[model samples]
Target: MNSSNHSIWFYAVATVLSVALGFFVASHYSTSEPVYHHAQLLPQPRALPEMALVDQQGKSIGNNLWRNRWSLVFFGFTSCPDICPLELQKLASLLRLADASAKLQVVFISVDPERDTSARLREYVNFFHPDIVALSGSNTELANTANFFGAAYDRSVIIESKLFSVPAGIDMPVNAGNAYQVNHSARVFIVNPQGAYAGSFMPPFDAPQLWGDIKQLIKQ
Candidate 1:
């Protein structure tokens, strides 16, 4: 073949190969993950960020506290009149349906550290179920853990509004007056045995659905 023709052919082959490689990489990266109804795997499950908090026993707690068993974690305060109670009640009911020796743990992490002392939380959790673990931490630890789970809690600082919202056990911050209240996300995060976020269940939580999902994860 002529030199000019050979050169053109070489360039064409290289261009075609480059295009193919690009398409292959794009396809691999753009593939959508499977959708799970209750608890599914993340495309890339991230480790729980470092945390240092206290448990219902006032014992130091963090990610290590979650290492051994499957944990269903909720972030709220005992003073939360409705949402927290309802969620824990549902969780208790679900646990009742499972074996007492099941390798699952329900954790209630307090967002309002100022009020949910270890003793208070211990008494509070018992009202729902004896097995439930109510956890708390310093404000910094609580904030870090919440951020890892995509939850938020901010004490209202406004002094003179007539809005009435506070956790059930907590009085409004006196310095902030009546407008201040604690606000946090209402979602339960499921952590698998590997201590990775397996999935999450948001409210309007159906006990049957949660049960089914938990069963699926257990068997897996």
Candidate 2:
């Protein structure tokens, strides 16, 4: 071949090789990714916001508590009539299903700070799972933390023997005299070992499916 013809052929072969290499790399990485059956993995992990909260043991904790282990976090209150207790039970089941060596933690952040003191949170969560970390904080602190996770809550008020409407799907009895309730998000947030907001699982949770997803994430 002439000199110019030789150069063109060489460049064309290089381009083809580059394209093939790109595809090979992409395919290899894609297949290696863990598949999740229940947990929704984020496109990118998000950093957690600074928070000041107290755990059930009255110990001060913050974003650092999320580091070093995978966490399943739920937002609710001690006085919640249905969703809160049911979700906590689901988390307990997850912990039970996890292998002993699984570095997983369950966190319950109480949105009803006025009623859910550190002591009250301790008793409430211990009933469901002794290892569950129950956290309560001042309204401002709680709001900031919840907002970071996209969790939301509101306190129901009793006005002259009339109970304000609770969130739909929450069953609050009319005769809950002088007892107010909290309406909050039921989705369980997931935190990676690096303390990043990784993903979430929506209720009604299937314990076995959740376990499968968690194991896959742990392996990754």
Candidate 3:
């Protein structure tokens, strides 16, 4: 072949090889990484930010609370009209469906610190599941913790009829003047046993799928 022809052929061959290699790497990755039906895994685990908060028992704790066990961290408030109760119920179902050997913990962080005292959090969470850990703190502390987990909340929104909006036959014990709503993120964060932000599960969770994903991560 002429010099120019040879150069073109060489470039073409290199392009083909590059494309093939890309496909090979992608295929290998797709097969090697655990297929999660629900959870969205992060590209890499992230260290959790420092936080100073109070637990349900009025005990002072921090990010270290997530260490030593896999945690499904959720952010909400005790007075939330809908999402909080639904998610907690889902977590309760997950705990029931999970294997006894599963080293899993559910952490509920209240964003409405002014209303959701440690005592109130304790009662609210325990009503759903006894094992759930409820945490509350000052606005600064709660904001820092929520931001670290990519959660967001806004307390400025007010709904005068929020108290009356609860479904009939459902008793939601709200503190006096708790007629406002705090909009918050609905995502549930996943923390590794080492207390690192690992991944997250979006809302509308399916207990079976969530359990499957957690089981897979537990084995890893």
By TM-score, the best candidate is 2
Q: Which pairs clash in model 2? A: none
Candidate with maximal lDDT: 2
Per-candidate clash tally: 5, 0, 0
List the candidates' TM-scores in order.
0.73, 0.78, 0.77
Query: Which window of ten consecutive residues has the lowest lDDT sum in model 2?
Result: 167-176
* lDDT by residue for model 3 (1-220), tens: 9999999999999999999999999998766787888789888999987778899999999767877889999999898889999999999899989877787889998887777888899899989999999998877777778877779777543245443332211223444355666778999999998989999999776788899899889867
Model 2 clashes, total count: 0
Order candidates by TM-score, high to low: 2, 3, 1
Query: What is the per-residue lDDT of model 1 for residues 1-220, given as tens digits with 9 covering 90 to 100?
Result: 9999999999999999999999998886545432245664555656787677788888887677678788899988877868888889999887777765557889999888777789999999999889998888766667777777777666655555544444333444666533345777888988876778766887777667777777666665
Model 1 clash pairs? Answer: 79-167, 79-168, 79-169, 80-167, 80-168
Candidate 1's C-alpha runs over 4 A off are 1-37, 157-174, 177-179
Compute the lDDT of residue 2 as modeled in candidate 2. 100
Please list the residue runs of candidate 2 whose C-alpha ends up more than 4 Å from where it truly belongs after superposition: 1-30, 161-178
Candidate 3 collision pairs: none
